[model samples]
Target: MGPLLLVVVVFLGFSVPPYLTFDPSLSRLPPPPGNHVYYPLLVAHVLFGTVAMVTACFQIWPAFRNNHRRGHRLTGRIYVFAGVLPAGLLGLYIGWHTAAGPSVRVANLVGSALWLVVTAIGLRAARQRRYGDHRRWMTRSFALTMSIVLSRVVNTVAMIVLMPQVDTTFLGSAELMRYSAASIGPWLSPLLLLLLADWLLERRKPGAARPA
Candidate 1:
């Protein structure tokens, strides 16, 4: 498998099983108190998000797309409809209802919204036979899709850096430090990844010199 696919698979392996158990105790973040629908929405989001991640590998695999055009198209459709669409919508609901605090809510809201919009535009470009545009947009979409992985990394670093300052900066509230770290992950990861994607896309343009 390509490195990207391998990374995604490893991420899924580590992250998805707990949710599959349908046990609230296994959730990475606790559901909001008295929010009857929160757990269910989170589960649905995870299931569909898994679909998106898996199918996205096939959609981006050059060998598969080049050698098996029909399969590529099929997987692309699955990625859009069955994967991102439901996942993105469910994520919005979950984000809105999360107990993680304001920064996290904003991050989730913006990230989910951007994922949906970028993917939809990519699909539209593909339908219009604007392959270049389609590719660029989908690159951004994929970056957003994989931002979850980067978010984890960012969260870890943020937590480590913030931990030392908890007493002074966070007023000795460990919970506040944790929430602050959590807040950085969702938005910062996607923002950085999207910028990277844009840079890569620009370099691939016609007449641009290939990277050494």
Candidate 2:
């Protein structure tokens, strides 16, 4: 978890500054041609997603959760309402309208939809006072929430492997190669994280108390 939090911090530190000025020119990925709303939406997504990432660290911290139950619940609410809710909603629109190519578009759509759904289920479990269910679902939610970081790692690695094949496999189109590599990470990262989350959950004794 410490490493995860550090990654989040480092990601935000590097990624958020350019957007702080609200300059479309500074966008990491240029918005699709003539999609005037894209930059604004990107800003919103990044801001709220930042909130989600930060709050999630606390939400999953065993020491924090154990020592401050009320803080845990409060942070959980903030994470859901202020973080994933807005970020996920914006992500759906961004995904649908992205210019990153069909593969990345599909990945964005699926990942955003799944993120929203998993988060909703987690919120529902908490509302019903099902701590165990809530913990399981939120664990999955956290995995999805943090998928962006892992996706970056995956994207970097994929780019490294795919770059050399661009002339043959990508037909000399760097754009295609870029988007294709970008696509794999979004789809693959969440799946890996969710599997890890479930595996961790399964290792626990049945009916065990929710993790602090």
On TM-score, the candidate that comes out on top is 1
Q: Residue pairs in steric clash, candidate 2?
A: none
Minimum summed lDDT over a 10-residue window in model 2 is located at: 203-212
Question: How well is each residue in 13-37 modelled by candidate 1, as lDDT tens digits?
Answer: 9999999999998998788888877
Instruction: Evaluate model 1: give its lDDT.
Output: 0.92
Candidate 2 lDDT, 79-173, residue by residue in tens: 99999999999999988888778888888888888888988998999899988999999999999998998899999999999999989999999
In order, what lDDT does every prediction score? 0.92, 0.91
Structural similarity to truth (TM-score) of each candidate: 0.96, 0.94
Candidate that would win on lDDT = 1
Query: Where does candidate 1 have its weakest 10-residue lDDT segment?
Result: 28-37
Error of 1 at 33 (Å): 1.4
**Residue pair clashes in candidate 1:** none
